[model samples]
Target: AVTRELALFKVACTVEQRAEILQIAEVFRSKTIDITEETITVEATGTSEKMDALEKMLANFDLREMVRTGKVVMARGTQIT
Candidate 1:
C-alpha cells in the first residue's frame, strides 16, 4: 500500500541563514511551522522517498533537530464502511 508521512525539521541556523533554509522548504513544497531568532521549524508531508530527499538536501545546514512521523492512512472520500 502507498503511504505518506509527515516530517518536521527544527533547524538552528542564524537569522542570516534563515532565508536560504526557507527557500529549501519552498523547494520541497513544505511549510514553515515556527520561527525563532535562532531557529526555523518546517513541516512537510509526502512519501517516504520524498522525505528522504528533503533530509539529504538539508544535510549541509546546521539542522539542530528533526522529527518524522509514521505513515498515516485515511479515507479520501465520504464512503463509510
Candidate 2:
C-alpha cells in the first residue's frame, strides 16, 4: 500500500502564531497525516536534508513548543484504505 496521496506533515506552532503560521503551509508540509495535536497541519514533500532544514527553521522561529510525532513517510499513491 503506497499512500502517496495520503502523505502529509502536521506541524503545531505556538498559539500566538497559529493562524499566521498555517498561512505558510507549504514551508513545512511533508504530505503525511501528522497525528499530532488538533491545532495545525501542512502538506509538503522533501528529503532528509530538507526535513532537517525544516526542523532547524522551526527551531529558529521558536515555533516548536512541543513535538507530537516523529517523521513518517508513506509510499507513493498509498493510503490507509
Candidate 3:
C-alpha cells in the first residue's frame, strides 16, 4: 500500500471572493474554519503530492494569508510492514 500523510493548510482569500474561493478549496477537499469581512480561512488535508498540487492551484487566487502544516504521521502502537 502507498503510505499517505496528512497535510493541513489554512488558505485565506480576499473578502470579496469568499464564495468563489470555496470552489478552489473544494477541488482539494478543504473546508472552511473561519470567515470574516476581509478574509476566509480554510483547512485542507492530503498527501504531500496532493498538497503540492493544491498549493499550486491556489497560486491563481489572491491570498491575504496562507499557512501550511507539513506532512504528519501517527503510529497506532504498531509499525508498518
CA lDDT of each prediction against the hidden true structure = 0.87, 0.47, 0.66
Off by over 4 Å in 2: 1-14, 29-44, 61-81
Per-model TM values vs. the true structure = 0.82, 0.37, 0.65
The TM-score of predicted model 3 comes to 0.65
Candidate 1 clashing pairs, residues 3+ apart or interchain: none
> Top lDDT: which candidate number?
1
lDDT of 1 by residue, 1-81 (tens): 447899998888887888899999999999998998998899999998889999887887888788899787665567442
Candidate 2 per-residue lDDT, tens place, 1-81, comes to 322222234455566666555545555554333434444554444554565565555554444333323445555554443
Put down candidate 3 lDDT per residue, 1-81, tens digits, no spaces.
343554444445665666677887777778777767766677777677876787777667755455666556665556564
Question: What is the alpha-carbon lDDT of model 2 when measured against the actual structure?
Answer: 0.47
Model 1: ten consecutive residues of lowest lDDT: 72-81
The TM-score that candidate 1 achieves is 0.82
Residue 48's C-alpha lDDT in candidate 2? Answer: 49
The better-scoring model by TM-score among 2 and 3 is 3
TM-score for predicted model 2 compared with the true structure: 0.37
RMSD of each: 2.5, 7.5, 3.5
